[model samples]
Target chain A: MNGRCVITVGDLGEFGIVARIAGRLPQGRTVLLGPGDDAALVDAPDGRVVVTTDLLLENRHFRLDWSSAYDIGRKAAAQNLADVVAMGAVPTGVVVGLGLPATTAAGWLDDLADGFRDECDLVGASVVGGDTTRCDLVVIGVTALGDLGGRAPVTRSGARPGDVVAVAGRLGHAAAGLALLQAGRAGGAGPGDPAPAELETLVDAHRRPRPPYPCGVQAAELGATAMLDVSDGLLQDLGHIAEAGGVGVALDLSAFTVPEELETAARLLGADPLDWVLTGGEDHALAATFPGGVRLPPAWTEIGRVTEGEGVEAGDRTSEHRGWDHFRT
Target chain B: MNGRCVITVGDLGEFGIVARIAGRLPQGRTVLLGPGDDAALVDAPDGRVVVTTDLLLENRHFRLDWSSAYDIGRKAAAQNLADVVAMGAVPTGVVVGLGLPATTAAGWLDDLADGFRDECDLVGASVVGGDTTRCDLVVIGVTALGDLGGRAPVTRSGARPGDVVAVAGRLGHAAAGLALLQAGRAGGAGPGDPAPAELETLVDAHRRPRPPYPCGVQAAELGATAMLDVSDGLLQDLGHIAEAGGVGVALDLSAFTVPEELETAARLLGADPLDWVLTGGEDHALAATFPGGVRLPPAWTEIGRVTEGEGVEAGDRTSEHRGWDHFRT
Candidate 1:
């Protein structure tokens, strides 16, 4: 008598969920057909298409108790989209493979679809196709496709020594959110509910990421030499750029335009914002290297410079920040 | 020994397993680049591509205790490939998103990769790209892409009255295999333990499905009016074709060549092989409808006829089998 009533998907079925999710998809040139048939046809005019995939499982990637199904959907879609954006391609469409229990609430699936569509719509992409199967827990697998538009793909290996290192979108907030969730769960902060601190925002960031899509394409248009998304920690991902580029990277701490909210939370959490800036993960921020003196877009901020060095740096030292490690803690 | 020295993925990590898996992928046409990059691109000649996705989780789809990782990989690829083929298109490539616990063995991943390549090679297709992430258990999401090569995709909705229904692969073996496994676990006569029994073949069929690949293009070439692959049982998938094509179907069970091995196993397991033939799932057999005496390939068997009726039938009556229901059980 004290809880919300749940509506099982058995009550709604597969096609019913598709109908709900398909309603929010953006009308786009790349999507020839939305999601009614056995398969979908998408336009890949580049003669070549960029593609990446990711999977997020319940409790493993996100906890349903902490985040709504919608948030999980958005996070799933956003991360996969970010991978495409990292290739400096415009995400055209996404195919979602959702595994949910038979008893899962229909409303939850609808909300998750909403999140998927809302995120895809922001990137001018649509949910072109998908499959739904029953499982004991929620598992989402997303495949993202993008159009290069005849532009050369900005690979991670193309950066030169003199390229300028830049970043777009906020970083570290998602990690901060994870930390907040962990802290709240651990009760390391002097017992009781701590007056519902700003940790909720951090948790929200962890649950839903806002990838900077437009900035990624802009980097390509701005003549970036190479690019990649910061799905891992900035320092770790930057290390990839450096290793692939076969050059050293020196980032100036002063250059990172930390989001004001992150800075405030950093203070409240008794942590260094720079740690989040360098070591946090899941922001899905775009990081690219452009030729020196190139005019970059407004969303982008100059983070550092690429040089003859052999490793990544933060004000002359190897940054101690390492982002999410799939194996090691 | 507490337990045989079991190895886990934590020792190798996600990227390490990917490196091993991607290393095993064979290069093929349409794959501009394979794994190791942020994303991959495929050459889409017709300016449009057909896509379908599916999610198969461990235990629910396959038990690790019963299936080797290699078998799981093969089934995963085979199922997805069948979907593209069902659309009467040539499968070009596939991208897999695997969510597995950090403790999974490196050998398991290698076997899985081997399985993927074997099935992809069977169809002259390629494993172009994939994503690997950590999870508490194993979950596989596969997205299959196909090239129409300017041929209009043959869908399930194109069958008209008087269309001839045919099949391009064997059936019921997988279902029989499941029955055998269940019987064995339940301590029944159960398809005689790993012996030279019919259950061996049935088990093999379930572990790795051999879908009809060339039949898709051949059916399209031979002017198949409607087509679908049997993933969710024959009666069920055929029902989908009937519903989509807006026609009734009558399957002549006498025409079905029940493999003697499966029949023998079913008898030993005290199960009805006919039920497996009609209602069991995951054989991935291709079912197509042709108009008026259209010749089928040597691999195909004429099963039944499409009529102006309202539902599907096998022999004298409407199919009592519900076919397959994922959520229902």
Candidate 2:
């Protein structure tokens, strides 16, 4: 760190920066032509590709002051990869669009690329190609492509009455972490900080969401119908399925046993843990509705049932709006 | 326009804005499942997908004050589509990631979508999916997918000595138009305004580049050794070919006959038209090197030839740097 040249992106120039970024990426078998080309060729073995895009603005989607470049990269990759998983597909490759300030340190980009590569490696995917440009703020746009592997894509419009609604990963943790950070109680915590285990877990989840990626494919194999990643809170994301499928979802709150850690953390903050469970988003959890009487996959925990009508209900509380509205804030 | 709602994007919210934007796009045969789902399914018939991505930041790439939202959308689509074409493939679909201020007019997004659709229509492609987020400045990220139609991708490394260099689109027009805009001479010119016809043509070209999309496939069919779109000026872009092919490119100055209008416009501005022709970029013209004996396509004009050694030369004047460097500014 002391002897090496730490040049800025401006000093390296666009082509130079691109060359370095491309050099560090490990191209897998899927990449026929990698960077330094007009376009990249990736084998889509399934004959059809599942494509999804996500835009992450600097302060809106992430805050550099709170999260390191590595965390930001992981978060960006996780969210986009989860989108492909939600479609019941195997992740293939991702093309990224990165906008950085000219004065940004080149090492920051290196760490970001490592983050992308590491996250992609978790799903057996690869970073194929990307475009880099200059912007005042860091803007990351990821377009993830996936292969269905002969399975039908599970869309949000297939849930029906009598279907069991289930979730495959933790919820509300990210929101709780965000709350802790917003309150300035978590970001500065160090290795020996006296933060509770629950608070620490929530904060880490907020920084890097570990979505249950495999469960998406497993759910599809087990005949799950309507599906989506829990991005805009559980109830809010569930509402999308309800509205798309023209059905209602009535969640059994008792099925969700609030973790003792979360309860303690909630009590510490004087906030309702139930609200976080119902409305906290960005967990990247897979929520699906399966036909009743089918053997449930081990990864899934039944939490609700599809009902006749519209909107979502938790216990006796039914509402049409229970999610995050990006523009409202 | 009077009593009806003129809601901003903030008023409509993310889902509402997405619904409105998705409602207006014409999904073609390629899109199996379009925008309302977590991801879109587009057919990749050739079992391979040619992919590329680009980021366009406001002010850095396009200025909202100078171009309409519609024009901005068209420009973004054109650049990405040109990348696919440059790879010797036909475009299939595009997924856009748009970052906008919440206060942006909902109608602006509608026009942007229309512009995207209009440009896609020109290339027989569709808008498959997108993600939108709130940001201080408008940033557009487009990932374009293309089908190779069973042909090997034309890469930059295929150019060799004894190849005839040719181009299939206009040169220097966009740069000339940018100059006019920068001089504050074109935007305010009305129908009866005193702006020269040539200046108007340049400004229009700058606003919307019409790449010779088909010529890419045509060049591939003709067994051209190498091909790329002229994105960073003839000299600057050709340098990519030279570096990649391990060869030199020599341009014939006499081969270029400056358009009378461009010359007149250049004189009016006291600028040398030759400099614009030599250093201008973003015309998105197909630049290729065909075998010397191959019958030159009618769409292409012979401009130069591949030479031994390295770097590019034009009438004994040669420089490694002659194009836009994003970090330089």
Pick by lDDT: which candidate is best?
Answer: 2
Tens digits of per-residue lDDT for model 1 on B28-89? 88788778777887778877788889988888889998789999999999999998888777
Lowest-scoring 10 consecutive residues by lDDT in candidate 1 chain B?
B185-194
After TM-score superposition, the amount by which residue A251's alpha carbon in candidate 1 deviates from its true location, in angstroms, is: 0.8
Q: Is the docking of candidate 2 incorrect, acceptable, medium or high quality?
A: high
Clashes of each: 4, 1
Give i-RMS (Å) per prediction.
1.5, 0.9
Pairs with steric clashes in candidate 2: B233-B281
Error of 1 at A83 (Å): 1.2
- Clash number for candidate 2: 1
Model 1 chain A weakest 10-residue run by lDDT:
A186-195
Tens-digit lDDT string for candidate 2 (B1-329): 22346778887888998899999898998888899898999989989999999999988889998889999888899989999999899999999998888878888999999999999999999999898878888889999999998999999999999999999988888888888788776855643335576578888888889999999999999998888888778888899999999999999988987887678668766787877777888778889999998887688999889999788999755884488877675
Candidate 2 residues lying further than 4 Å off, grouped into runs, are A1-5, A187-194, B1-5, B187-194
